[model samples]
Target chain A: MISSPENTAAVNIHRDDIGTRMGIWLFLFTELLLFGGMFFIYSIYRFLHQNEFHLAALELNVIVGTFNTAILLTSSLTIALSIAAIQNDNKKLSVILQIMTLVLGAAFLVNKYFEWMAKINHGIYPGSDLLLSKKPGEILFFGLYYVMTGLHGLHVIIGMVLIAVMLRLTVRNKIDSNNFVRLEAAGLYWHLVDIIWIFLFPLFYLIT
Target chain B: MENMPEQNQKKNNTGYTKYILVWFTLIILTGLTVSLAGMDLGRITVATALLIASIKSSLVLSVFMHLKSEQKAFKVFVLVALFFIVVSFVLLFSDYSSY
Candidate 1:
């Protein structure tokens, strides 16, 4: 019946205890299936109109895409370090690293803001402009582009919130060496975001 | 295996070195991919770029994400996801070619 400082739950619970780990894994599997559906749609559309997809992709900003990829990769590294720090019982370092990761995630979103703005400035909105030579296929391409990348961006926002929660937990000493599963779960989500970008980079920016 | 091995031992291992080296290689590979975009490689350009990106992703998954060290069930989960991804791609391609 030990009481936790931040909550009424037990304080010495093993972070990666079997049940907790299993639950997180289940949630992760659901996430995979969810995104997997979207990827399927993307493949269908891209394969049907390869030329249109490639031409539409050429309109994207490679510099911003590359920068965002690098930013997300660095955030993944920092989150991994945060997990390592917590496992080492370095509470302060863990909190700082978590905050740093959050900041980097936000920075990536900000860059995305400018990138989207640039797209709009070029009159690339869905169903509105025939800026490219592809005609009807361009509309489909932009539709999938917005839906896929928009969903990915929403995940990034959620990841930021998750990290913030873990930061609070670390500050209250609820996420020490013995119980750092939350950080690991959040780290897993962050890495998945990075993985999404790994595919997106080529699909959007490297088109012929 | 209640805990990860000692920090010093883990740090000294070849895997750690390989992870850092892969990160460096990723940076260079990204630059090369973008630079090559200037040249007209036709559709093959996208294929080649994606191939490199996939390789980089595998390195990150195996090392930084610690997929190689995770439990067998977790590994199976990832494999299952990949299996379905392949299935979806195949199905989509078949439908796409019918058009």
Candidate 2:
């Protein structure tokens, strides 16, 4: 019996979730390598300029960093829960959880903005004269701090966008139980963003 | 082999309470790491902080990312990527530690 062309195509798509996962995992590996290179540079610089890095870390506000850590961690939990909600076919709860995740993410960026503003106000940014005149070790430490955390902030923004889109799709019923791979993939991306910050928290704010 | 029937039956096996538990543990670990920084443990602070961070991230990855239930092939792919991260760290640090 010859199945209709549409039916065959539908079956093929349904059967290839693993391929979809494989593609995303490959993409995630490349991301790992990208951040891994930055970390390599960070380690070498920290080793050579341990004293400067320590003093530089002292300038960071541990309170704000700790708050942002809690915020990001909460957001991670929300996103993971959203995936579970959708898998159980609770579309409304899933959307609510995603929205919650986005709010937590926005809160994190707001906190980060205040932190960076405080630093930039003091001329602590990369290439500022006050920073430029410091020992090269100190300069390198702050430079890596801004670049690593800034890159991480960018990831947070991207994760928010992904969650926003997924939330919209979930609302439209485009991401229900039968087609939740999209939601799952976005959750993985969001978790990676949190994982990066997990490491970043200690290196920047607590290493003093 | 992750047959088609089993794949179709796949749904998240984790309970909602587990996510909360993980989050609580992560928050407590963050507090510990921050407090450790203030105690003047010298170099051990950095080591202890990173060790806790690793533990926290492992929970996020294994549970939240659903790596524990993922196929063995994908698990290997992830492990290989992590191996490269370690490789880059060790080979580069070997050259820099003496300088």
Which candidate ranks first by DockQ, i.e. highest? 2
Per-residue lDDT over A48-161 for candidate 1, one digit per residue giving the tens place of the 0 to 100 score: 777788778778888898898888777877787787777667788778889989999999999988888888887776655455544656678788777778888999999999
The residue-by-residue lDDT of candidate 2 on A3-28, one tens digit each, is: 69878787666446677778888988
Clashing pairs in 2: none
Share of native interface contacts recovered by each model:
0.45, 0.83
> Which residues of candidate 1, in runs, are more than 4 Å off?
A1-18, A129-134, B1-22
DockQ per candidate, 2 decimals: 0.41, 0.74
TM-score of 1: 0.84
Q: Stretches of candidate 2 above 4 Å error?
A: A1-15, B5-9, B12-14
- Cα-lDDT of candidate 2: 0.87
- DockQ score for candidate 1: 0.41
* Model 1 chain A: worst 10 consecutive residues (lDDT sum): A8-17
- Deviation in Å, model 1, residue A27 alpha carbon: 2.5
What's each prediction's clash count?
0, 0
TM-score of chain B of 2: 0.87
